[model samples]
Target: MRHLIPLLFLAACASTQDPPRGPSLPDTCGAGDYSYLVGQPARALERVLIMEELRIIRPQTMVTMDYRAGRINFKISDQDIITDVTCG
Candidate 1:
C-alpha cells in the first residue's frame, strides 16, 4: 500500500487548489448589477427578470449547501427586505 498512499496524497494536494473562476460569479448571474436591490423590498424583484436559476432564501429558511453553477441567490430578511444578492 506504500505506492498507493503517495498517489492518494498527490490527488489530495491537487484538490486543495482554488477552483477555477467560472460563470458562478456575480456578473455571470447578473447579481452584481442588482446590488442596488439590497435594502429594497423583496417584492421589487418581481419586475426584474434574471434569466437564470434564481433562488429566494428567506430568514430561518433551510437551503441546500450544494453550489449550483450560474444560480443567483436573493436573500430576504424577516421584514421582507432584500439583504444580499450573490451567485452560487
Candidate 2:
C-alpha cells in the first residue's frame, strides 16, 4: 500500500505536466499559391513592397521583416525576378 501511494502520486504529477510545444507561425502570414508569380515579370505584380538584399528608400504601402504576413509580400532577386510570394 505504501509503494502504491508513491506511484499514484508520481502518476498524478506526470499527468499535470504540460505537453511539448512546436514552433509556431503567425496566423496572419502563410505560404500561399505564389508559385504562379515565379518567373513572371516583377512589374506585372500590383503595388507591393519589393524586398532585396540591402537597399532602402521611403516606405510605401509595403514593408519587410524576418517574418510577417497580412498582405502581399514579394521576395525578389537582383535580376528583378519574383522569387517568392507570401501572404500575411
Candidate 3:
C-alpha cells in the first residue's frame, strides 16, 4: 500500500498540465495607422499605450522588436500632448 500511494502521487504530479494561455498577439502590430496620433492630444486616443523610452518596455503590455515593423509607442508630454510617434 505504501508503494502504491507513492506511485500514485508521482503519477498525479507527472500528469499535471500547465495552465492555458490567453490570446496571442498578432504577428504585425499595425503601428503605421497611428501617425495621426502625433501632435494630437494624448487623451484623444481611446487606447494610449505610453512608453517613456524604447529601452523600457512592459512585457505584459509591450513587445520588443528588432525592426520598425510591428509596434507603435507614444511619448506623452506633461501637458498631456503626444509629442512623438515611434515604431519598433
In candidate 3, position 28 carries an lDDT of 50
Candidate 2 residue-wise lDDT, 38-66, digit = tens? 77667756654344322221224355455
* Winner by TM-score between candidate 3 and candidate 2: 3
Better of 1 and 3 by lDDT: 1
TM-score of 2: 0.38
77 Cα displacement, candidate 2 (Å): 0.8
Local error of candidate 3 at 74, Å?
1.0
User: How many collisions per candidate?
Assistant: 0, 2, 0
**RMSD (Å) per prediction:** 8.3, 11.5, 13.0
lDDT of 3 by residue, 1-69 (tens): 877998897888774678889875443545455667777777766675543223223224455457654
lDDT, candidates in the order shown: 0.87, 0.55, 0.58
Model 3 residue 30 CA deviation in Å: 3.9
Candidate 3 least-lDDT 10 residues: 50-59
Model 2 regions more than 4 Å off:
1-33, 46-68
Judged by whole-model lDDT over C-alpha atoms, candidate 1 comes out at 0.87
lDDT for model 2, please.
0.55
Each prediction's TM-score versus the true structure: 0.66, 0.38, 0.39
